[model samples]
Target: MADFDYDLFVIGGGSGGVRAARTAAATGARVALAEESRMGGTCVIRGCVPKKLMVFASDYADLAEDAKAYGWDAEIGTFDWPRFRGKLHAELDRLEKVYRSMLEKSDVEVFDSRARLADAHSVELADGVRKTAKHILIATGGHPFRPDMPCADLGLVSNDLFLMEELPKNVLIIGGGYIACEFACILNGLGVDVTLYHRGGQILRGFDEEARGLVAEMIADSGVSIHTGTNIVEMKLADEVDVETGTISNSDAALGAPAKNDSTSLGENPKSETRQKAGKRIWVKSTTGREGTFDHVIFATGRRPSTADMGLEDVGVELGRSGEIVVDEYSQSTVPSIYAIGDVTSRLELTPVAIREGMAFVETVFKGNRTPVDHELVPSAVFTRPELGTIGLTEEEASERGEIEVYCTSFRPMRQAFIDKPARTLLKLIVDRETRVILGCHIVADEAGEMIQLVGIAVKAGMTKEQFDRTCAVHPTISEEIVTMREPVRAG
Candidate 1:
């Protein structure tokens, strides 16, 4: 396939790639897009789409319990793992087909193989086929990483977790990030014994502090054993010959601490690091000398841009110190004709952000419009037990720049109070004291993500606190707290 005739070639037919390719092609530019795996990338296939579905499914478990209080005699429920998995797979399959059809209808040349840089303006396919274009775009996304522990290979990564043959009985998730938090909710909701271990005081560390505290409280109350400030030092697979190995898998106790070593019992038998190749038990030692075993282990650590094996360096595309491609305001790479968008550029990892960036890139170059991506006030959500959503600055952050008035509210959610669930929803607003502008708005509660979407629009439009106050309150709604807050809880 030595066809070298195109104006723009996008690598990786994920969200950004498809958006850019379709947009560019619509503007009378010859476009080619190559994707090795399923279209729609991580979000549609494995990450956001399936994960959010799981989150919605998980929330039902609590809702079922809460239903009894609402005068419905809901039976103690059992989750059908196979049914849920089948439904998720079917939905993903439909989406994949839709993405394919959309690209085909747009007249964008689609390659069903991985695209690697053959030269600055040319890319070679996995089968040694080559194609050339005036511009090359890299939209390859990221993958989850599992560290090298004794039995690290035995556990599953993010993509692997989605494709599990069957649901786990007891799952031990190793990570403190948002991914870890979301997975804990999934497994626990599915009736799996889930123990989450993170080497930090809180999960979702970068989010607002109050949001972190509220999620921690809600998740623990929902039956998840949230272990913070703990690290998994070593992992040993289950069903090993050594009898003492089983004790090393306990969750509450630290595994790797020097004091916990039973020197007398082992008789110097080479420290028993053996693991069963097929079965699920993993012996892990943490920084706190905690040892635990679980039926399955999931590594929800983090991700890096999927730029490897694609030959970015060969194409002379400049990458940041973090290995992300350097893209300008218009998402153009250092190479004048080449451009990059989405996670590969490390600008914003959200699916919507990638779509917007891809559209902006197409608008600037193809449509002859000078459009620049502004990433300042995009809002995001985390789907943990008590969901988290925030946009704009934190109270401390806004105050650090200048004197600000902080309005804070914490109260038991009306529904939870009646159900005897001891969970509280938190809301805080940082308003500039001089301008009365709402500098930031943050919320940590049920439907926090859903609530923050509207708040994000207000923040992006630079809405002031006075405007928020002037807006009529929607009575009996939690979100109306933003408009109804009477006084600053703290002023500095």
Candidate 2:
């Protein structure tokens, strides 16, 4: 037998990595993990934690407006962006420390450097230090991606949005995904003029059409200027240029056009490139020839796997066409000895999925029990203005595969009816027509994220429409719509 330094060596101390390492160590297997950044990875540092705080911070605007109904005198209202940023950072730092402490308590050695594949069973740290292990795991997750425009350098990605010292008075965010909508809601609620642009006809593309429409309406009501089916073809940055007469003036056309040596026109008109200089803000011509600008631009477009620098090719591990690692139901990579889980593998990009996969992997490999993750009933949430929560299949998907009955209810919540908030909530239930089993539950409302979790459990337990109807409704609660809506509007 070959001597190994550790039983398992994990790269990336994110949720999947930490969970696997801690669980494996608890089973009496020696483990060591390496992280190039902070301990809690994206969820703790940038993605979930900070994003929720922003969501809460943005809610105060509406809450303040509603304070009068709660019998408080309408008073002055103010928001200090820098103060919120400071408090958010402090909390994040504390959480990072707690995660580190937890891993140490589990007896997992944590290395604070990038881990690169030296070989199938060996990992090299950033400083050329190398270590060998019997098995390896990669859970590096992913990073935000921005569109490639002429002045892409001047734009900000999702990760960078949290660190801004000052908020923009008017911001232009590009993308239709949840990240873009969430940030648009956050900024618009906090009094920033937000304009959202996307290439799709509708936002939240994969979600149910009605739920997506409701969220789009709620976001629009929250004061965001939304633009769908659009993208920036060119960005004309505002910069000073000296004219031939030796006078310096702010010129939009002064900056050279995007390089054309690469055969891409960059969607710019050569004849009118310098002829259409505008004011302080540069005009960005769209694919449809529309032009506008704002003080700041953010691209919540999408994210790609962060496996670029980790040296996967060196280890001969294969990745999917989408650049995610390929893994089986047991989270085992093509290389039998190594395994992967979480966003890197793209099974489902939720923390719970990753956690379950981590536990399952450890069970089969170390604890002598084989377990597999069932991805069919996974639940997800989108923290937009009204919030969105969903589990299982959409009505269209359920209908396409087999006959199904869809129950849907739409109404203005009591609070909104009183305040005239110009918004409403949507609830939907999809069930198999023949079997009568609940197939999906979708909610779009204020606390939809919290509300759908219970519904998810019901569906996961194989609840039927009759079972849902037999349950008593909690009077005056928004969630009661789930069980009370006995009839669905027919869709031919």
Candidate 3:
């Protein structure tokens, strides 16, 4: 028998890789892992953790006003971005330590370097060190992408948002996905003016139409200027825009459109030193031919798996068009010894899903138990101003499968009603007419993310509409409406 240095060599230190590494080690198999960046990958480092912290900070923006309505003397002071950023970094540093500790405790060997495939069984590191293993798992995760337009570097991706030294006074966000909408809400809550542009006719395209629509509505109500069917055609530095922009068309105006001048361009002060330090004042022209200058332009356009520069193809691993590693139900690549999970596989990009895939991979490979990944009925949450939680097939999806009845409700919850806020809560369930099974559940409200977890359990269990109606309602709460929604708002 040919001997290997380790039984399992896991690549990527993100949640998925870490889980697999530790679990495999616990099984008394020799395991090793490599990570070039922070140990926690995107979720702990950039993607979810810090983003959700910003969500928490942003949520407090309305509290002072709401406090006044609740008979409290309160006024929110100016946000201290530097201090918050410092603490955020400190927290991230602590979490990285925890992740490192988990591997160490599991007795998994760790290397602080990037790893790629040298062959079916050998893993190569950035420093040209090669480690041979019986099996290899790739979970390098993914990264946000910026468009390939001229002067596109002037725009920032979602990853850049966390590293900002100072938040911009105003920002123009491109793309209509959850990341774009989430950041729009975050910036608006942080007292920054936000404008959003998406070429799509609507945001959150894959989600249930009504639920995503409500999320967009609440985000826009929070003062995010959303322009669907729009995209940036041209981008230039303010200095260049000032010198070269001779003819500015107001696409909306037919004739006598006003040309932009220096004083009315972007900011009142337009400090050159500040502009240089804050990157550059960017002037953007929309596809519709309208123009505007912003302190920052963010492209939350898309994400690509981190498959570039890796020698996967040479070793016979199939990759999808998006550069995601192609794997089967058991998470095995075409090269049997090489497996992948997480965002790298592009199956389901959520952190928890990645972790689950890692466990399934372990069970299939190490335990003599072959387990195919179950990609069904996974619940997802978008942490906007009011969160969006969804599970199972959407009304549109369920209807296509067969006849579906959509029972949905939209109303100002008691808390918002008491404060007289325009915010409203939405609860929806899509049920099959014949099976009487609840095919989907969608929620748009505060704590919707938390609410959907238990709701997801029921949906995943294939509970019928009658089963839901059998449950008792928790009164005086936003979620009670979920159990109490009896009649179909619409049917097909």
Candidate 4:
């Protein structure tokens, strides 16, 4: 222990790493944290915080319309991208400072550079500084993944959204996942002509089918062109497209065709003016035989763990197929002294889960308590136009396990009904038939994220359906419907 430079050396400085470092340091252990980028990591810097702000900004468009319907002379104007981006970055900078101050107050040494594992018990910085620790933790998180396809480099990922100078006029979003749908809605609300192409029958593939269906309907109704079972087959810069007077090839049938090398090559230097301008306008041919020119092509396909070149595999730490660190319930890697958590571990890639796992790691290593982090009944939200909040199991999942009763309802809410808005809200409850316990709760409505949070507590507490019925409903609120729901719509 005396030979080690720190009692604990935590790598990556994201939510999980920062929490473990600060908590361990509170116990008077000499803890050190290394982060290559911003202090607050993905959630505060790029992922959740900034994305939610965009969600809020996007909602104002609908709000103004609703205001007009309510007889208020509320005028809606163009979204100021530059102004919003400036304030968003300022807020992120402030948050990073707060994270740094928290570590400083906790007496944890922080290194603002990249760190890689040198051995089971040591790490090396990018500057060749070597430090040994009695224990090491990895929380490097993840980055967006782009498929291996020609012209793939020409598309933007989720990270690029925050740095854009101006929103595009016509955007093509690829992927059926939450990130893709959320951005589609966000851009559409910002007055962009958005086309979402998901190579599936519907969007939000893994969510509750009913809830996701409602979301898809709302997204389409809000002026987004959704093309299910569609994908890009070939792409070129707008300038490179040959405007020939011939029949356009069937894009869907051209899926297996040898793609023609378009004028603007993907390998073109990004910093060059041509490449930069090309990003403004892309010509794409989709699998559905549709050819169109778009201002931008955004790929939200997926994300993989950021575990490459960190020397984890060299030191005998097992990695998953997607480069995720393989860790046990205690977050201990194959190597005894090494541990991993957060998105890097590929376990429930949410900020709260990462923070909790970090606390559990502290309890296991620093406090001499072997506490296993529970990954069950985690509440989550997809911030689409209407938003979807869910917890526990999906109806499809619960029915497969055992007999279940589904209480589902969809209707136009009072506010929208009064204004003759076509918008509708959905509230659903899945109960175990044998136990009469609420197995899952799904909501598709405004502030569904806020509603599902409270629902999480009830579901996690194993509250029965009767308990929910016993609770008094708060009048004139959307969430009150959760408690007031009676009679199962479908039981099996």
TM-score head-to-head 2 vs 3, winner? 3
Off by over 4 Å in 4: 240-280
Clash pairs detected, candidate 3: none
CA lDDT of each candidate? 0.79, 0.80, 0.86, 0.87
The deviation in Å at residue 120 for candidate 1 is: 1.1
Scored by Cα lDDT, where does model 1 land? 0.79
Mind giving the per-residue lDDT tens digits that candidate 4 earns over 189-242? 888999999999999998999999999999999999999999998775544333
Model 4 Cα displacement at 258 (Å)? 15
TM-score of every candidate relative to the true structure: 0.91, 0.91, 0.93, 0.93
Clashes of each: 13, 0, 0, 3
Q: What would the per-residue lDDT of candidate 1 be over residues 18-78, giving only the tens digit for each residue?
A: 9899999898899999988889987888789988888887767767578888889887667
**Per-residue CA lDDT of candidate 3, range 388-416, in tens?**
99999988898898888999999998888
Error (Å) of candidate 3 at residue 452 is 0.5
Candidate 3's C-alpha runs over 4 A off are: 240-279
Q: Candidate 2 at residue 119, lDDT? A: 84
lDDT of 2 by residue, 1-492 (tens): 789999999988878889999999999999999998888887888788999999999888877567776667776467799999999999989998998998999999999998888888899999999999998988888777545545564556677667766776788888998889999998887889998889999999888888898899878877788888888887655532322233433355435434321111111223222222222343456767876656667777777677775677667888888688888888888777778888888778877788788888899888989988778888889999799999998877777888778899888999888876677899999888788898889999988999888888999999999999999999999998888988766532
What is the lDDT ranking, best to worst?
Answer: 4, 3, 2, 1
